[model samples]
Target: MTDRDLTALLERATEDVVERDFAENAWAAALAARRHRRRTLLTGVGAVAVAALAVTAVQLGGADHPKPTPATSSTTSTTGGTLSDGTAYAVMPQEGTEGQLRDFDAGLPSTIDVRARAEAFSAARPPGSVVAVYLRADGDDLLHPVLVAGDGRHVLMGDVDLVRTTDASGNEATPLGPRAVGGGGRYVVFPQRDHVLRLDAQTGDTVSYPVPAQHVEWAGWNAAGTRIVARASEGAWSIDPSTSRAEAVPVVGGYEGTFRVTATDALPSDVRVTRFDEDGRPLMSTPVRGPTWSLWGETVNTETLAATGAFFDQNVTSKVIRRGYGPIYQGLLVVEPSSGAAKVLLAPENPDGQTGRVKGCCTVLGWADADTVLFQSLGSHGRWVLAWKTTTGEVFEVARITTSAPDDPVTPIALNVGRRS
Candidate 1:
């Protein structure tokens, strides 16, 4: 088909869809950058047919017909419910089961009484309860940030206009990062022109931290969960949530317990992980070889690190080469950055599966405890937040996200899992 013809077809096909544009190239670049940022860790962690069209693009671009299968899941007696931060989820008994997963956006109101709902949540809910926030679809070019709790509670945070100067990069969509839900799940931060807006879910209060530039991107909390990390026009900064004090930091990485973790490419054969003390002094360096991408933190202990990566052969005899650096042979990689030891914790039956689109097996949400790491996986089964036990190799479905249609605006922009470890 001609370029104009394809454009017309796409427009006609998406007339009833939301007004947001889903450019594959743009999204791929964004996804790649996001994946790169995943390796640089502060220790954290689509709608659209754009859905059909993107898949079609992949099929047209490659001839590698790799059959994909779901990763093995352990059904052992796993119980599901609310987490410590009031995030709710279900336990999947089998591969195809939805368990207690329901449409999180079902019956969502177009408008919400932010103050009253916040007051109600504060009064009725016990301590340690915070509502998760999501950027819901609104009209053609606007997004509404809604607060969600595990008990099916919903609160509208505010509306963000895409056509305006809300984002410094001029991108209409929300910036993807760990800061969407941070502060131990007690807060959600987003950008508003020159300041970083912080929503205190526990108290139904909002605080603004002004920056020097128009668009300030937040990186969530520091290793200690006391300060917020961010980057703006000036440089990298660490902000104290209590006093709203912003301090510039030379380098930012992940912290677990007492150690600060960072990684770099030493040579083509391996990536070097360095451990630093609280005073920013390097103590040790370990080389890990073969992981295409590695993420640190989200571990039961500081010695172990969790990551997602893919592998490929140097030579391909097929007619069509993989067109882009899309998702390939990927899985959950368990790495001991301190010892330079690495292994696959879980990998899809087909590493080059369709859902592996720029991400891998899943995105590590946080460490649920010393033994279990929680992550959101997209595969043949569906989109799910699962708990994987590193010691036992058992997988428990924590929650399954349900969307009404391919173009449903209720699509989740960010996911928050309470860090219990």
Candidate 2:
């Protein structure tokens, strides 16, 4: 047969065998199906995870998509079993958040024995050595103060009012909140007009100490947790809760040993950090670039004179950032007080509040150890407590925290730097 005739015959045969090309459509449909199935499975898994957190008391984990290496909780519980892993930080639920969890039939107890809880927790860990001081919503305006150890043993302190009210002098006093926790985790303080109510976590005792000034607000504890500081209309004062002696002192930041660290606001191109002695003398000063706001909080390493910084934007003004900034930056920064060296340790891809990403990449909770800095991160699973080794730059998930309130997750409060073995 002629070559042209043979080709025509082959073409006719091909046309008769093949009707239409549905390969592209089939592939697209298959991809869509796979994605849908994946999403559904993840959702189911997430729901189960949430339920587990509610039932098990505190079973925490990281993102459902990118699975993180599970670590045990920093604490070793006596009654409760060991936590999944130790990337754990203290978290506070919003007022309505825990209430919503109860509404969802999470079986959360309405009333918990505050003293019994504290005693149980103290049995597992010692006083002044806590991992976290958090507020748990209890279907009221008052949030229950909880003392959580590294092993996940928690003590629920009775509720206290958080409503902002004007003192006798007509000055609006700051509302009592999670920040009222003492550095050692041995005590939790709240302002009550002319007096401060201090709760002892070990003995479940409450003491009221009179303040020299009216409308005093809790300013947290000194770096050593030995003295409780409060601010008033007149001035700031540091009180020795042991002796009930209150003395006026200059407002200092992160006080540790004989030194303290302070940073300027997010107004200029660089933040001026100053280190001061216990007597309010400037020892050293350094300028750190980046960090529009230091909302992530700072803690100083006394031995190295280095502090942790969480910045919203690098070298950006607060005014510009507030006006709807784009591609904003958020990460962990380490600043040295003596050498004036600032380094960005971990810079995550997406900014804060980005959809389909970690809620916040890193917020410095405090140093888990001398070398490991513990920070909190939020993802699809829940809030995760992560650890970063400054010496080796090794980062890993320490603990996963899924609160009873899944929709409105808990926010990490100050981390208890003390991790007992």
Candidate 3:
């Protein structure tokens, strides 16, 4: 094919991935491009091999195509298995689309975090805004707080970015912090300099409340979603998102309440992770045997499910990767809260059988209760999702989500689980 022809082919593929709402991530797009490049390289590697094998595009149809069907959930006994209290899952495509998984019937109600912008259909601007949830897709270190909703009707709140990043050189940009949605899907408040953006989940309406403009140590809604709390240069204060009111509460010592997640690299040979009760009592302390460890969750929302990231056998992995290997296997540990014991739930990442692609990043979303933890794998054709049981170490199949557009490319995006009232 001509160079121009190859360019067109790549563009077409990229368009397909994007139209499919696979992932809105630049890394994911790069992966799609690299996959295409690898395919091209493989085609030229051997002529005799081509003659020996012939494969077709993914299809199980005669006339057009048959799509993937969501697998029904199978759980182990509740004695320690993933809880199936009819928990529903909400997904966000990398392309900025959001919706609920009707496939296995999460059985429980779900609410998703989103930044709702006030846009006018014909010029009169709509009112209000919403919340943001930072997610680490695939195994990427960067966290994206993309806005997503449960109904699939995503509303862009504004151009304001919602995630913070610190470069390798120690420079930080977009200092957005952690935020949470209220119980029963009610309201949440996001902080911005002098003004706080508050929005209701059910309605797209938003209200801006004023606050101290100085940079705060941290800002987000309180656990109850009743007010916006932050530790400004002066002290920690809680502001009612509705009234733009502030109260001088005791400045939380960085982390508040019982610390659900803890990381200690005190020993180079053995890393440790521990969960604690609200009173600072250690619940479970498990030591991890690896080269590095990174904790992702604070405290358990309902259970002590936590995800830790690390690069195993660093020197060997680096050597292997330098030899033109696809990539080294980054590891994840799904730890138990009570005993502090841990298990490597996901070994080096691999391609999903259905999508034939791997996640650009491997990260844990949250728990499905005390027994199950949902993982966000945006590596394959679409966003690959899996639910892992803490006790049985069994990974349950969820949906591989994407846009329905015929030509859109699909990549994994972020995922969050919620329960209904």
Superposed model 1: Cα runs more than 4 Å off: 1-128, 159-173, 179-184, 191-194, 213-215, 232-234, 244-270, 274-285, 293-304, 307-328, 349-361, 406-421
Give the TM-scores of the predictions, in the order they appear: 0.55, 0.55, 0.49
lDDT of 2: 0.38
Model 3 bad stretches (over 4 Å): 1-104, 107-151, 158-179, 191-196, 202-244, 248-252, 256-260, 264-292, 296-301, 308-310, 313-329, 350-360, 380-382, 401-416, 419-421
In model 1, the Cα lDDT at residue 69 comes to 18
Q: What order do you get sorting by lDDT, best first?
A: 2, 1, 3
The deviation in Å at residue 46 for candidate 3 is 46
Off by over 4 Å in 2: 1-130, 149-152, 159-185, 190-196, 210-218, 232-234, 247-268, 279-284, 289-295, 298-302, 312-328, 349-354, 357-361, 405-409, 419-421
lDDT of each: 0.36, 0.38, 0.32
If both were scored by lDDT, which would come out higher, candidate 1 or candidate 3? 1
Q: What is the lDDT of residue 273 in candidate 1?
A: 48
